[model samples]
Target: MFISAKNIFKNYGSTQALSDISFEVNKNELFGFIGPDGAGKTTLFRILTTLLLADKGSATINGWDVVNDFKTIRNNVGYMPGRFSLYQDLSVEENLTFFATIFGTTIEENYDLIRDIYVQIEPFKKRLAGKLSGGMKQKLALSCALIHAPELLVLDEPTTGVDAVSRKEFWEMLRNLRDKGITIIVSTPYMDEASLCDRVALMQNGKIMQIDTPQHIVGEFPRKLYAVRSSNMYSLKDDLLHFPEQHSVHLFGQYLHFTAREREADILGLRHYLEGKNHQNIIIEAIEPGIEDCFIELMTENSASNEN
Candidate 1:
């Protein structure tokens, strides 16, 4: 395993930040840790990168224990934090040079490793890192992280605040990196980006909800689903939630996504119930489940089991 974490636990004051979180990343794979904000993604990343220690369990990168071999782990992994942490006052070229110096290397020594990405922003080498656009800053940060030619790359929500085009470009850059035989372990809140990974671990609160390829996870959605819309959208949601046959009710775009209580749920009865409630222009059509849908279902199941 390129990366391995077992039963890791972390705490912050009274809150349990991570609980028995365990997963492994294979060599040369693009593994994603999918979750929303405050889902303990950053906390787990910190522990894996050796910036923080876990209260319990163990983690290793490239077969070296994170705690005991912090020095070796730090040298072998390239980490791009959630926030841009490069020197704001320094120019892009200067920042890259400084990072290379710290790692006992020079830009010329590892130029080939970052050439593809660096070329995109090379013209702005003299520009201050703080003055560059969000996308450019992202490219520069990645350049510095890869300057030392680390075998593993750990990124924490690298595309969170960037524009849509920039986000797409960033993912393309990641794919290029993966092609270079660098193992990547990234965390993101965006469900759409999950499909791009070789495998993903859906996380919520402080636990791993599920781990599988995006196709497999979506393929395993256990209930029949439908997309519902009505002239009175607000009232329609309320009516569906109150419907005895609704397993779950959630908003998706301009429509409400519903999972039926039973496979044989009465579609006509549901439409009539909405009509009786004065919800005009009613439309309910069966649809396939998405990754977000599966995530919600798993979360709901987990919460209900805990309550019982």
Candidate 2:
């Protein structure tokens, strides 16, 4: 494994940021930590990158212990934090050069590894890091992170706040990197990106709700689900919430996933109920679950268990 952690725990003042966190990433795999803002992703990344100490448990990257081998880990892993921590006043070229120099290497030494990613932003190398657009900043950060050619790369929500096209471009670059044998561990709040990962750890409130290939996770959704829509969209959702056989009902983009009490939900009864409620243009179809659907199901189960 390129990255591994066992029973990790973290806290801040009166709050627990992580609870018994554990996972492993194999060499050359694109692993994702998928969750919302406060899901302890940043905290876990910080611990793995040797920036913060975990209250318990241990972690290693590329066979080096994160704590005891702090210096070696720091030198051997490329870390791109969630926030832009590069020197804002510095030019893009200058920032990349500075990082390479600090690592006792030159940009020319690893130019081949970064060329594919760096070329997109190279034309604006003279622009100040702060003056660059959000997309450009993202590229520059990625380029700097890869300039050292570390065996393991850790990125925390590298795609947040970027445009759709830029996000697509960034993930493509990651794929190319992983193809070249660099193990990558990235975190993202966007559920759609989960499909791009070889495996994902669905996290929430300092816990991993599920960890599996996106296909397997969605396949394991334990109920028949339907995408439901009607003329009265808002009312349709409200009515579904109070549905007699509803196991779960939540909006999924343009459609609402209606999981019934069992796999054999009453389609006829559902239609009749909606029609009786004056709903028009009702459309319903059995649909396969997506990563978000699976995550929502796991989160619901966790909530129910806690309440019990």
Candidate 3:
């Protein structure tokens, strides 16, 4: 395993931040931690990167124990935090140079490793880090993180606030790096991005709900799903929830993604109910499940288990 976490636990005073977390990442794999805010993604990343200690359990990166070998881990891992943490007063070139120097290396030494990302911002090399646009800042941060050519790359929500195009480009850069055999562990709130990873660990409320390939996760969705919409979409959700055979109901983009309690649900009965409720232009059709659908189902199951 390139990375392994076992029974990890973390707490901020009385609030549990991570609970019994455990997962693994293989070498050259692009593993993603998928979850929303306050899901303990940052806390777990901090622990794995040796910035913080877990209240319980253990983790290792590239065979180095995160705690006892903290210094070595720090040297062999490139960590880009969730928030931009580069020097605001320093120019892009200066920031990259500083990081390389701290690692007893030079930008020229690992130029090939980061050239693809750095070239995007090379034109703005003299611009102060803070003045760069969000997308540019992201690229600069990634370049600095790669300046040392570390074996493991840890990114925490690298695309949270960037434009759509930049996000796409950033993932492309990551794939290129992975193709060169760098193991990457990234966290993101965007479910759509989960599909881009080799495998993903779906996290929520300080726990991992499931870990599997995006396709497998969606394929394992227990209930048949349907995309439902009506002239009054808002009211349709409430009505669907009130229906006798609802397994789950979540609003996804422009439609309400619904699953019935039984696989062979009565579509006609559902349509009749909606019609009786005076809903017009009702559209209900079976649709393939996506990452978001799997995530929602896992989150719902996790929540219900905790409540019980």
Candidate 4:
């Protein structure tokens, strides 16, 4: 394992941040840690990057213990935090130089490692870090982090708050980086990004719900799903939920996604029931599951199982 975390735990003044969080990343794998805000993603990233120590359990990067070998781990991994932490007063070139110096290296020593990304923003090398656009800033931040040519890159929500175009470009850059054989472990709140990774660990609260390739996760949804839409969507949702054959129902895009209690759910009966309630323009069709659908199903099933 290029990265290994075993039963890690951390707490704030009163609230628990991470609880027995454990996972591993293989060499050169594009592994993603996915969850919503306050899902303990930052806390776990901090622990793995050796900026904070866990209260219990252990973690290692490339066989170097995070706590005992902090210096080595620091030297071997590139980290882009959730927040933009580069020096605002410094120009792009200066920031890159500073990070390289801290790692006892120079840009000339590892120029090839970052050359592809750095060249895109080299024209803005003289611009102050704070003055760059969101996409430019992300590219510069990644350039600085990679100037040291580390084997692993740990990014904590690097795309949050950026525009959609920037987010798309950022993921494209990540795909190129992964092609260069650098192990990457990134955390993101965007469920759509899950499919971009070789594997993902779905997280909620502070625990991991499932770990698998995106296809595998979506392939495991047990029940038949349908995408339902009607002219009176508001009333249609209410009527569908009240039906006795429903396993689950939730809004998805302009349609409602639902699982039927029986595989043989009567669509005609459902449409008639809504029509009797004055709902119109009913459309219900079986739809293939996506990552978001699988994630919701997993969390719902886990919660129900725990209650039982």
Candidate 5:
């Protein structure tokens, strides 16, 4: 394993931030932690990157103990935090050079590693880091992180707050880096991006709900799912919530993603119920569960288990 954590726990004053968290990442694999804010993704990343110590449990990266081998890990791992942390007043090239110098290397020495991403932002090399556009800043931050040629890259929500096109392009860069034998562990609140990872750990309330390949997680969703819509979306959602056979109902984009309590749902019966409620242009069809659907299902299951 390139990265591993066992029974990790963390607390912030009186509140628990992480509870019994554990997962592993194989070398050269692209692993993701998918969840909303306060899911403990950042806390866990801090521990893994040796920036913060865990209240309990232990973790190792590349055979180095995170606590004792902090200096070595710092040298071998590139960490791009959730927020842009480069020197704001420095030019893009200056920032990259500074990082390379700190790592006892020069930009020219590791230029090949960051060539693809840096080229996109090279035209703006002399631009102040703070003045660059969101996409350009993203590319520059990534270039700075990669200038050392680290074997493991840990990015905490690297694509957040960027345009859709930038988000797509950033993920493509990550994929390219992974192809070159660099292990990457990234965290993102965007569930759709989970599918882009080799495997994802779905997290909620300081715990992992599920960890598996996106395909397997969706395949294991234990209910018959249907996408339901009508002329009045709000009313349709309310009505479906009251439906007797509904296992769960949540709004998803333009439709209400619904699951039946029974393994086999009565679609015709559901349509009739909506019609009786004065719903117009009712459309109800079975649909395959996506990463969001699977995440919601796991979250719901976790809540139920806790209550029980």
Candidate 6:
């Protein structure tokens, strides 16, 4: 195993940050922690990277305990935190060189590992980190993280504030890195990125709701769902929520995804009900569930259980 976390728990005063969290990652695998903000992704990443202690449970990286063998783990793992923590006054090239130097290495020693990502920002080598664009800064940060050529890489929301194009490019770089035999553990609030990972752990409210391949997780959605759209999406959603049969109602992009109280839904009856409500150009059809859909269902279930 490249990474192992068992029954981890963390709290901050009155707030519970993580609850009995447990998971593992195989060598060279791209594992993702998929969740919205405050789902304990950053907290877990911190504990796994030996930057913080968990109040309960244990974890190991590359056979070294995260707490007792923090030095070894630090040497073996590369971490890029949620916030951009590089020296903003330094240039891109300067930042990379500085990070490499700290690890007792030179950029020339591991240029191949980060060449692809670094080249994208190389033209801005002279630009101060603070003056670079968000995407450029991210690229430089990733390059710094890889200069040490560690066995494992841990990134926390590396794409949070970047552009769409940069985010896509970043994932491609991660894939290329994984192909070179470096295991990766990344956390993202973007549900779409879940598919890019070999496996993902969906988290909510400090607990893991599900952990499996993206396909398997989405395949496990327990109810028939439909994408419904009308001339007035807002009113249509409110009306559906008010309907006695609706089990779940969530807005998905320009449409509303809804499920019924019964396992099997009455499409004709639903259409008729909408027509009676003066909804125009109504479109309601069964569609495949997505990661976001599954997360929402899981969150609803978690809340219901807590309430009960």
By TM-score, the best candidate is 5
| Clashing residue pairs found in predicted model 4 | none
TM-score of 2: 0.98
Regions of candidate 3 where Cα sits further than 4 Å from its true position: none
Candidate 2 residue lDDT tens string, 133-233: 88889999988988889998999999999999999999999999999999999999999999999999999999998899988998898998899999889
TM-score of 3: 0.98
Q: What lDDT would each prediction earn against the true structure?
A: 0.93, 0.93, 0.94, 0.90, 0.93, 0.94
Clash number for each model = 0, 0, 0, 0, 0, 0
Q: Would you list the rank order by lDDT, best first?
A: 3, 6, 5, 1, 2, 4
Worst 10 residues of 2 by lDDT: 256-265
**Lowest lDDT block of 10, candidate 5:** 297-306
Task: Tell me the spans in candidate 5 whose CA falls farther than 4 Å from its real position.
Answer: none
> Candidates' TM-scores?
0.97, 0.98, 0.98, 0.96, 0.99, 0.98
56-98: candidate 5 lDDT, tens digit per residue = 9999998899999999999999999999999999999899999
The TM-score, computed over Cα atoms with residue i paired to residue i, of candidate 1 is 0.97
CA lDDT, candidate 3, residue 234: 81
lDDT by residue (1-308, candidate 6, tens digit) is 88889999999998999999999999999999999999999999999999999999999998899999999989878999999989999998899999999999999999999989988998889989999989888889899999999999999999999999999999999999999999999999999999999999999879998999999999999999999999998799889998778999999889999999997689999999999999999999899999999999999998998899
Model 4 segments more than 4 A misplaced: none
Lowest lDDT block of 10, candidate 4: 263-272
Q: List candidate 2 segments past 4 Å from native.
A: none
Residue 274, candidate 1: how far off, in angstroms?
1.7
Residue 216, model 3: lDDT of 95
Model 5 misses residue 306 by how many Å?
0.8
